[model samples]
Every structure is written in C-alpha cells, then in structure tokens.
Target: MRGGNTNGPDGNLRKDVETALLRPNLTPWQRTFLTDIHARLERSGGQARLSDKQWRKIFEILGRPNNVIALPPRTVTAYPPRRQPSKLFRPRFGWVGRRLRWRLRNLAIGFLIVAAVALGQQVFNLGRGQFQSTPTSTRALQTQEFSVTDGDTVHVVGEATGTRLVGFNTPEKFSPQCEYERQLGERASSRLRELVAHGSIQLTKVACACAPNTEGTSECNFGRSCGVLQVDGKDVGSILISEGLAVSFVCGRTSCPPAPRPWCKG
Candidate 1:
C-alpha cells in the first residue's frame, strides 16, 4: 500500500508469479504464501499486483550471504628478560694480569727501600773506623823489616802496608797545627825510634775499624793497618803517654775521639 504506484489490471503478471512459485526451486516462504496471494488476487480480480515490499523480500532471500572470514584473535607471547654474562664467561686472564702487575710493583718498591737502607749504612760507617778483627799472634820484627814514620805510625820496608799504633797518638810532625806541636812531634818521633831500635820490637796486627767493602779504599785510614807495638814486653804506647810526649788515644768499636794534644794547648 505504501508503494509509489499500484499495478493495472495485469492478470498476466499475477499468473506468471503463480507459475514461478509453483516451481520446485521456490523457497518455503514463497511456496506457503503462494496460495494466499493467489486467492487474494482472485478475490480482487487481479486488480492489485504484487507490492514492491513483497518483491524486495523475495529478492533479498534469493541473493548470496555475506563472505566474511572469521579468524581467531591475535595472540602475544611474553619472553623472559635477556640474561647478562657471568664471570665465568669473561676473559680468563684479566684478573690474573692485574694481580701480577700489582705484586711486581710492590717487589720493586721493596727492592728500592732495601737499597736505600744499605746506602745509608755505608754513609754512616764513613770516618767511624769500626773495629773488625783482633790478631792474637805476636809478630817479632827486625829493624830492617820496618821503619818509624812518626811517633805512632810505622812503614814496612818492603811491604806496602803502613801501621798505626792503636793506644796512643802524638802531635802531627808532617802537618803540625802549631810550631810548639811540631817541636814536640819531632821529640816524640825521636823517642819512638830509640825505643824500637834497641829493644825486641813485637808488632801485633789488628784489623782497622772501617766501613763495609772499604777495607782497601781510602776511607779505611788510607788503607793503613792497625797494630799494638811492644818492646821487651813493655807497651811503647804506655811509655810515650806517661813521658808526656803522646796522648792516650783509646777507641771504641766504631769510632775514636780526637786525641787530646797537650803540646798544642795554650
């Protein structure tokens, strides 16, 4: 009834639709409503043709269905975080190399400290005249074997060794500090020569107090040997000290005090 126009007296169109609905290919709705629609058309004497709404429904049923493909929803998988490398996987010698370098550096520093101590000890021993060894055997000497150098020093005739008396020191004759000292030194030297010339001279060699590795060097009393001089079992040093010619010159293990010179005193 709501269509734009009504059909005319077209009995042929109604007969044609009836003929199509009777066919075997017709839908269930088309077949069931076919008799109803024909009876109505007969009642109206085919004055009303099929409406546009009924025709549109029949055409829609005859068309193809939608072609939508149904797929499952997208899935997202979660994985664990990336693992970091362990110490085992690192370079094998990296720690070893660092430790070895540290040890070597320490060893080098230790060596330098040891060397510095040794050098300092050597420097401290200088001019100290440290006592080394004492000889117990007495050596008897003839007049030709040695010659008196001064009041307390003697030179071996053929040997290059020089001897310094251990117990006493006289004023310097070769390098005197004053004229009176020179005169006293000459008298002391004359007295020593007279004592050694007449009596049985006994010389006992003693190791000079010197620094390590400096026994032959100039630091060791110019390479002079130390000795105790005795004539006829009497110590020459005692006789000289008692006669007011030389001063008592005692030495400790490492050093000796400057000899007290009476001749040079004002």
Candidate 2:
C-alpha cells in the first residue's frame, strides 16, 4: 500500500494553502507568508516533499517577485528533497566550477615553472666556478654558448661565465676612446658574432679580473674571465689578430698592444 497522509482537515488545509500560493498576482507579503507556511507544514508533516510546481512557485516569488511574466515552474515534490539553491545567486554553478578549474590549472603550471628554475640554479652553483683562474685549467665547464659580448668576449650560462677571448684585444666597443675606436669596435664585434655562429661550441671557463668597460684588466672590476674561444677547431682570438681586427695580448708575461687614444702620446 502507498503510504501517504490521509485526506483529513490538515491535508485539505495544506492543499488550500498551496493553491493560494500558486495563484497569479500575489502580493509581496502574501507570497512570503505562503512560502513560510509551506515550509512549516512540510517540516511538521515528516518532511513530505512538495511538487515541482509548488517549489517553482516559491522560488519564483522569492527570486523575482516583481515579474508578472509567467514562466515554466520547476517541480518541488521530490522525495528526500532536492538541495535548496542559494537565495541570492544566479544560475551559473556549472560555469563557475569550470572557470575555477581552469584558473587552478594555470596556477599549477606557474608553480611548476618556479620549481624548475630554482632546481636549475642549485645545480649550477655546485663547485663548478663560473670564472676559472686560467684558460688552460684541466677542468671543463658546464655551459651553453650564447652570443658574443664584444670583439673578444662571449656570454654563456649553465653556470654563467663571462668569458674573454685570450691572447688578443679588440677595439673598445663597450667604452670607446674616440669615434674611430667605437667604429672599429663595432666591426670587430660583428666579425666575432659570425665566427661563433656554427655549432654547440666547445666551452671553457677562465677567470679574468677585468674592470668594467675595459677589454683585459687584472684588477677585476667586472665579473668576467679570460678564456680561449674556439669555433670549428679555430681559435677566435687568433683569427681576429691575424685579420688585424684585434691586437695581441698576453697575460702575466707580455703586455697588450698599445692603446689607440688621444691620451697616448705620439
């Protein structure tokens, strides 16, 4: 047998109440009263759920009480009761969930990138000095050759070495003595770029304690190293020197070529 409330005075009263609520052009206060009464009746009657029509009427009244336009109402008479929606929220739950998921994915990717960079830096700093003391050092370096710094230097990293071309000097591109020197420096830098454009270069690390904007300095004003640059089994320094693009420089034994300057006395 179907278990239900017997149609007594209480059931008739409940039916009357629902009918009144479901009628058109209800006043704001009357609609609110009907909804409250409906909720109380269901609570007292062992939570016997209302029909979709009844639930839809209550929701419409509460959500858009001013709208006179009739719309299809949702069923409320669900057994065990459907989850009540938030009173103030619009119906965008699915879109909200999807957007939140998308942003969470981007956040995860960002965290992964940060973690990788940190790991790489730690690996780089482990006992492999960026600027080695001499070019002839037996220990090899871990670096990827990038671009030439000037006529006699190139930039590298994996351990971040600022390597200078050993055995020669080029015109001062970084800090030129005169217009002529700057012009020559640019030409020298161009040639150097061409020479190193071939392959995964044989990397070396040598420490040079050079000053900023100076080609070769023992004083070490900037973080740089003196290292031999080779491209395709050819020494870049020797090429520049022979081609007259650069002048010879020997460390701790012979001096660099005479500076071309207004400061140099004739």
Candidate 3:
C-alpha cells in the first residue's frame, strides 16, 4: 500500500516499470501490473524515471513468456550459405590456356634476343674488313716487256700468240689525222711500257669489245675473254684519258652507259 513518491528514492521501482513495459510479450497478469505502475508514475508529477540496471532485470522476467523473445540461441543464417570460392577464380592453372600464354611470351622474348644477336654479328663482320692489312708486293703479278707500236697501242710478247692490249682505239694508219694520232699513240705506249717493264703489274681480265682472241678474232670465242692493261697501280684507260690521247670508252652493258664525250661521237 505504499503510494508513489515523486521526490522519494524509488529509482529501482521506476526502472522495473520501464523494463516491464518494453517487453515484446507479457502475460495477462504482467500487462495489468505494468499499466498500474505506469499510472502511478504519471500521477507522481514526472519526477520518477527508471534506472537502466533495474530495467534490464524486469525485461528478462516479462519476456520469459515468449519463446521467440529468448533469441533462438544466436543461430547463424543458412539461407545465403557461405559459398566456397570457385576453383576457376584461382590464379594457378595447369590447363592449355595458361600454358599457351606462357609459351607465347617466351617465344616473343626468344625472337627479340635472336634479332639482337644477328644485328650485332652483322655489324661486327662489316667492321672486320677495315682492320685487315694491305696485300704485299710479292703477291702482285710479275712484269712483262712490251714494244710501243703507236701513241695508244703496244705489242707485248706472250706465251700464247695474240693477246691484245685493251682500252684504246687509235685512228686508222692512212686516215686524215693519222700522223698526229700515231705520234700520240706511240708516246703513250712508250710511257706505259717503261712504267710496267720491270715493275710488277696487276692485270684484271675484264670483258671488253676491243679484246682479241688467240686467232686475233675480235668476236668472243667460247669464253668471255678480255684484257685490262695495268702498269704499277694505274689503269691504262685512265692514264690515256689523263694524257688527252684517248677518251673514255663506255660499252652499252647492263652496268655501263654509252660514252658521253664529243670526241667519241660518230
């Protein structure tokens, strides 16, 4: 029969009343008790409020009637069961797709390495020729004696009968300027014979139209035989051009064009 006191020490009773009212499920007798407590607290002029500790205890007592309110032993949800990560998501693979990708990468690297090595070898071979020493004089051709026929022609005795000196065409013996051309040719031939008579001469056999065969035939025999007369290291054609006695002759070959000089024209 204790009436509620607004200014009195009823902190525990107010807590109990709040806890009982917050319960999700209550019996008929519990509901009536909480309503009566609430009414009594209202009449106390708003000074009675519940403490937290006493409210928790009263909440446990009032919630005992509901089995659902007992919180079902904190059961883990099985609706969205934790899926084990798929094997496809793993990076390690022994299949063809991964192996093919690895092989392609290795092939690309190997090709790049081979290309670099080939380029380096080519450059090394190109520069190797520059460091080689010049050839000795003993390796050069032995000189042969010759008689000067004219300004641009010479007669050299050979083991075989008729090997003509190439690269100059003198005027005909009875032509209008024959005397002048003959004098020039004789002088040129004498100078060439003197330069090559005792010294070694490097002869390079080239295909030429004016070269003669063994029977003195101007046409090609079974072979493409020709003559290039070189004295000391100078080409006889270039020497004749420098002396103004003979002009340059260019045969119409795949490599050489027609001679471009006024003197060479018909």
Best by TM-score: 1
The regions of model 1 sitting more than 4 angstroms off are 1-138
Where is model 1 poorest over a 10-residue stretch in terms of lDDT?
1-10
User: What RMSD does each model have against the real structure?
Assistant: 63.4, 35.0, 54.5
lDDT (Cα, tens digit) per residue for candidate 1, span 1-266: 21212232332535655666757876454565555556766777765434322333333333423222123244788998999899787766688888998999999999999999999988767524333332364456887787777789887654444678887889865556577887788899899999988999888877766666776555666556788899998989999989988888888765667667777777
Q: Which one wins on lDDT?
A: 1
For each candidate, what is the lDDT? 0.67, 0.56, 0.48
lDDT of 2 by residue, 186-236 (tens): 798898877666533455555443434553432441334567766666677
**What TM-score do all the candidates reach, one by one?**
0.47, 0.38, 0.33
The positional error of residue 43 in candidate 2, measured at the CA in angstroms, is 68
Q: Over the full model, what C-alpha lDDT does candidate 2 score relative to the true structure?
A: 0.56
Clashes of 1: 2
Pairs with backbone N, CA or C atoms under 3 Å apart (clashes), candidate 3? 150-185, 150-186, 151-184, 151-185, 151-186, 152-185
